[model samples]
Target: MITMVRNVSRWFKVNRFMGKCTVIGVLLAFVAVACLGQLASVQLLNGKSTAQAATASRTKTVTISAKRGKILDTNGAVLAQSVERYNVVADPELAQTFVPTDCKEKTAGNCQQIDGQPVGTTGAAAVARLLAPILGMDAKELGALLSGTGQYVVLKKEVTPEVMRSIDDLGLNGCVYGELSSERLYSNGTLMGALLGGVNDEGAGVAGIEQMQNAVLTGTDGYKKYERGGEGVEIPGTVTESKDAVDGSDVELTIDANVDWYVKKVLSDAKEQYKADWAIAVVQDVQNGQILALEDTDQYEAGSDDAKLNTSRAVSQTFEPGSIGKVFSMAGMLQSGAHQLTDQFTVPGTITKNGQTFKDATQHGDEHWTLAGILEQSSNVGMVMAGENFSNEQRYEFLSKFGIGQDGLGLPGESDGVLTSAASWDGRTQNTVLFGQGYATNALQVTNAIATIANKGVKQQQSIIKSVTDANGHTEDAKTGEPTRVIDEQVASQMMNAMESSAEHYSKFAGVDGYRVAAKSGTAEVAGSDGRLTSIISDWSGIIPADNPRFVVTVVMKDPQGSYGGLTSGPVFKQISEFLMQKYEVPASTPRTDAIAVTW
Candidate 1:
């Protein structure tokens, strides 16, 4: 019984050990299966992440530049425009190993021979020989560039479409590339050059209206997002996103191209005739305040390096206005009820006031003169004596009212001109101010200031831009400011009478055949460093068909060789006026009148 019991105990111990082993084996199998599941999950997640990364790497985004706007004149002629240009690029390595596939009857043997490498020099020479004449380049120079080690090199820039087409017909097979580009072209070279401004290679406006209205002239750039292939090439039918570019708006100016051409021609002739350092001209519609022409001799090409330095002198430069400014002083005195057009005063060759001496343009004896005669004589003493009736405050008020030192006309570099405040005036300055001295003004300011008289003392704001047209063909007209009454109609009419008489003094140059004309001529001395007269600013301002006064024309010349305003600028003003009258077909307002009295 004990043996049997021991055997049972041993058997029971063996069975329990086997049971434990079986449980441990099952646990081990479970752990292995859990570990394998976790590993499989990690590998699956990693595989998905890697695939996503690979897909992301194949995507590319391209930005497309918007088409720049056009700059058009009032007559819808293109003054400045963005034109399609190209850059010729060569894959030197590809060119070195090129094989011309276009085997025409005339080039088959040469093409086939180019495919062979008998000479140590690569096939670049063969390619250059075929491309040289069409590209306007020498074969040797082209061969050297094509034989270089670089993968890509620029062969030519700003090539014409015809040249590009010729290059394309050669079938160079990845050896040559024509990259698209643009250039700013001025249709009328050097006409309105400074006002039209310039653009860079990327078609960004850098100066003038182009710079001032760049945002309006430059459109929104678009973008394209596409998937690329493994070789970094665009994949077929894989564009993820695309947005078309919006072209810029077109800017139409108030300047008439035909008138501008004529004015420039007249000024050029005057500039040459007078042997002057600078010449400027401007024409305006006195009734509407529209500037018909603004020109200066200092002009430059659109794409030239000198463009940055060259600016419109009429807009930016200022000089002593000289006798041209007297029109305003006379208007002030008349409006102040201090003088009448027929009022008589004894005028002398010179007058001294507050230790400052004023004189007539030339030596003359004392004589009785009417207001009209005083102006016709352009007497500094007469102007000072007439202005003495009004206070300094009255003179400054008139100057400001006449548009002196007013806000800029919205040009890029417009000047407001100089007008001394009453508080800054000394005895000399106060007296000199009466005769249009001790202050300075630009051509535009002087032209507009005198225009107040021509417009019957209605000051109209000047403008350059006429309208803006968007890509969708919607045009928005540019607003010109309202006209303000600066003087009474009666006062203006009386001033006009005096101006007509004054203009008659220059009748030799200003008188138009069968037409009544009103004008004023001035010669202001340019002060030297020692406060003495060194140079002269000669100018003429006038109205055409003086009886009705449709247009106001002004001509200014600086430092002319031995000439005054009537001699240098008067002829230019007359020619411009005649051309304008004929061009606009303005009929005669009244019969021609005799010369008014200069001395009484």
Candidate 2:
């Protein structure tokens, strides 16, 4: 019985131990399965989101500024350009953590030490102390900027590359950096100042050509996305995305800088000598209608506030063209077969027609003059008689064809001038229109009108921009419309012959040596600042080497000391024509053999 009882006790003890082992194994299996499930969830289901959160903490995006294009003259001279600059930027939050290291050995760049001792300051104060001298700022002011809690702050803007390099040499451990930027620089101070225009603080064009071609001059900005370390340092091989900026296209103008400078100087001198309110001048290539030089007296320094505010007077101001209108009317007469240049007329000093009395500049007895002679003498009565057969519609039609009161150059703030319908003309205005009093036009219109006669009756589109070269170096010439024939070629020749005779009348005052000029002068009464019809506008337009025209020059002055256009503006014409001839090496004029008789 004792052996049986001992065996039962041993068996029961063995079973209980096995049962405990089994329970422990089952618990261990359950714990292992829970750990595997947790590991899968972390590695597969939520891994991407967790990794994205980590990247968001360290990644940063920065702007890469596009370089603005340059404005160049036809001769490849730089008129306006962008100079490389930088904006000194700082991370105020990071700057506040800046700490200088103590110098143990006297080695350069080994430690942040001032005068062979440790920098005795910490955080933003230490940064400010090192940066203030280089930046030319007060240490206290810089410290305040750096003590802010913002991540980004502009320390100084438009710093030169030299200054930026010096700042970089300090090695501020990523607390400060330079953002690439540029400054628009006009190399020639006040040359074409108001016309070239200026940029705003944000580098956008606000006036003149800068505003007109803003799209061509502006570029697309790019960006860079990368990871940075805790110290604001970009991590190696962590740049995830980046795109390079596209620089703006370079614009080349049709103007010659040297000629423009000379024209401006001449206009300025004339404005002072004549004691006039203002003066304007324009020169154009007759063959292609490309404007060579356009200038006015109200010049301002480029990049100045005045440059931003003022419009170009050459294309903006309007006035009666005075007797310069004779060329258009005479062209009309010859074109419509109303009269021939050789036709005879006995013109008195004054005459009345259609209840309107007209007079010449000077009183004279009855003179036997041909149509050509009538024009040479610039007789208002002669034009009235010549236009006896010229219907009002014919008058308006000819003026329209000649581009009077028309849009010119399409420049900013350009005026199209005023030309009322023929139906609006009164009896006095109808006769006055025949002599250039009833309509108003700008200087450019007058210039191109005469240019049409010089171009053998063909009118070419005027162009200021010569070409555009894009960032990829692809070049394209400025687009323009096709030339139009304004009149028969024979009629243009007759007008040119008549104009040559008129030019001789002003030869003493406006003649260019060795060049035959086809010229006309005009003096008109315009409204002054007080809106009184007392102001005098004296103007002269001429084509040099008339037989083979190359350049057409025009000069206009307001309220000049000398009232007559031929007397006041004539000499200016001579000076500019002389320069054009000498500079271009133009051949001297051939003797006139086909000259028509002015007296019948």
Candidate 3:
């Protein structure tokens, strides 16, 4: 019995071992077959596709746009500012499940129709309905827009934060919101429109002072990307990418909003009163050669679309300034040692030169007048005689110093009022230019000429921006100085004296009061195609508070109802001078020096 039991045990053990071996072999065979299949698939079907897919994933990159800089006035007032906006998006593929409607469903499957879009569906229609009202768009249109096969598509851009929140609560399937940035408001609207300009849809300034100083205004951008789990929870400190954005430098303008407002108001009112074709007004800080206010009323309104036109007539347009321009001729004579304020001109009220008659403002003609009296009366003949005394080269040099035909200034668009070469000044031309008959100049160039005298004969380049603000609320790059010299101090002094005298006399005549003023008015007939004066167009310009001048104001009246500077523009000038005097607390000009002596 013991021998039989041993034999059975041995057989049983052998059987068990064979069964285990069979199972192990079968497992090995299956693993080998699977390995072979995987290798073949990689070589024949997956290698190139995998490589191409990876390349495609890395090929196209996405970039977030940076926000532009802000523009401010001298007082740290926001002239141009940037605000955050949003773009709404939808995933049509996922949005098909929600129904678009006002009713809420008890379960995800039961979606309602909102504005005709199925909202409860996890499809594009629901996303469109939930977002359409918040975005102020037609849901039907939005759905159509989302019907695009793209994995992601934008529905609307520049959406405010409020709208973004409303969309987020809807929880529409596949709907996402994106963020964009742009400037929101202008402080004064169109007060300094021409100077501040505007940024593009991408927030880049394309014109005006903004474009001119982009380098200083544009800032850098920064970004952060972190690894997030499926539920939007951050994997602690798992920062994927990070970059910082630099905020743009703040730009401060020299323009004073109050002054600009008044200037524009006065000019615009004058435009209506004179029934003029156009009008321009300007005010400057004589101390630093900074332009306080520069405006043209006939061209634009504070919020009108037409105001955005590119023409900077204030710094671009120049014409014969008529009598107002007589001051420059007077300047030339004084600078050239050719004439004096005391020098007398023959009594003829008119000068017949080159078969053209130049008439003085007064028809009841004074018999003879001093150089000062000639300017006071705006005598064409007087200027002609004085201009003759100046050699052509001498005349050109004097005007040249005033920036006529010069290629420089504070703001852009400096028109070198046409200065005929000495050779080009024919005898007729010589007399014609004396009373501002032939030459043309921009308002800024003319303003600068007066500014030179105001700056004590030194013309500084005018700049609209005065300073920039840093991140820490500290100011930087402040333009805190005066312009370079363009004229002799004494010459400027004499010019100021003459202009003040004229202003005082005119103010007296016009019955305007409360300020010591000096001014000159011009009513030059705009040139016609026939090379003769046209009755249609007229202009006026002058300096104010003549002694120790605080402001240089220029008024241009085009095609006035009266068509004369003294009649149409003189009143406006006086009103503006008096208004500015009170507004700026400018002390009345009490000349400390006796009038400048003219040398022969």
Candidate 4:
């Protein structure tokens, strides 16, 4: 019976083995047919698709961003710079393609589980949702990104470690970190915000010197080419080409940090102390027209609704300079060659021209004031009496010559200022303008006017840049705007003498202090709705260590806690000039041993 059972078992096993062989035969035949069909399609029917796929396999490329250039103050202190950052990337396609080995606990089919929750916040719909919060993104947005069909996708371009940790919790698949270029911080926050400007993510300059010299500041990008495998990792021995990045040039500015800081500090304080709406300050070298320090912090801060820095006023604000305009008025008259400093005028405490009533700040009845005294006390009437020398046409010409209508500062949104043609002038315009009331001017114009005076009647259009260096460190003197001399040297010296006299009295320089301090102070009632003076704006301009004058500085305080220009703007000027004197070790221009020459 056992023999019979064994025979039956063997027979059954043979039958089962035969059945398996038959099934294997059929499958092999079908696979052979499919392989032949694919071969035929590639060899003859439509080989273009195969060729394109192969070519694509050979063209993988990578990018390396160049580092950003440096920004330094005139003294070479770093202001803004660049550093390396990272971008996170993921291969969702690879996550789908991977397969696990027998020993591997994480397998291709269930790799999504290893990927944890997707980056998106939408619980089930997203691959990136899990990473959204850590990366500072909306789950819905990340989900949409992951659900897309791209072979490669940027998960996050800029991220912190705090963000990376959150992504790790997600257990995402095919996640990778890549390097990117970014801006480094400035130790000095907002110190020269307007001047230095900031960079965009793509490293493009938006304003100021940064924008002006972008080509030199931006470095060349590098490239890498390699054959990518099916999983998108580089194939071994497949790198064909690479080009290293060229670093950008380091830039240096002529701006002095200390000087800029001082200017900002004093002007910011004055603006607050005076409750003034705006303030502007400038310090420039007389030997060459390099602006050392320039600030317009108050108006912008007030507009910002905080003490924080914002809105640049230096190159922006334009208003009627009021009596402060007298500094130029005196210069223009002197430049016209018809005026002298000793010229005496019997200012009857007022002067009437074209039915306009012009009076001094306080009435000093019918007293003789020299051209020097008129400017010293900032007398509006006294200037009108002395202004008889230059014709209206000559006055306008002189104003234009000194860069009133065309300083060519070339600042964005720069104004031509308000100088209507004198030919269209009314009695009110002429008289009010005579004492610096009718015309409007910009901060640049005011500084440029005094700059012209400091430059000995030469209108050296003000510039802040010293030189622009190329990527190779070759520097070309910045494209300099031409200087137009508005007055003869002799006349300029005379007018400077008058200014010196005025400065001495206002500053209480008891005797001829060795320093040739040439200065002028102005206070004009800010004309309200009636087109007449009622309130006030105070301003001051001067040059110090007068002989071989080194610095020409202009400080203006608007609607200060006090009323007069001398009181509101004077102290700021003193502090600034004193600092500069000590910094530069400026000695007084030898005390005047004899009579000094001046023009009205």
Residue 545, candidate 1: how far off, in angstroms?
Answer: 2.0
Candidate 3, residue 147: Cα displacement in angstroms equals: 2.5
Error of 4 at 281 (Å): 0.9
Error of 2 at 312 (Å): 0.9
Sliding window of 10 residues with minimal summed lDDT for model 1: 112-121
lDDT of 3 by residue, 298-323 (tens): 44332234333564567667777767
C-alpha lDDT of residue 62 in model 1:
61
lDDT of each model, Cα atoms only? 0.79, 0.90, 0.67, 0.68
* Top TM-score model: 2
Model 4 scores worst on lDDT over the 10 consecutive residues at: 300-309
Residue 555, candidate 4: Cα error in Å is 0.6
Arranged by TM-score with the best first, the candidates are 2, 1, 3, 4
Position 92, candidate 2: lDDT: 94
Q: What residue pairs are clashing in model 1?
A: none
**Candidate 1: global Cα-lDDT?**
0.79
Residue 451 of model 3 has an lDDT of 77
Candidate 4 runs further than 4 Å off: 1-34, 40-52, 55-58, 95-144, 160-174, 241-248, 298-311, 509-514, 527-535, 595-600
For each of the candidates, give the backbone clash count: 0, 0, 44, 20
lDDT at position 387, candidate 2: 89
Q: Across residues 215-251, which tens digit of lDDT does each residue of candidate 2 receive? A: 9999998999999898788999999999999999999
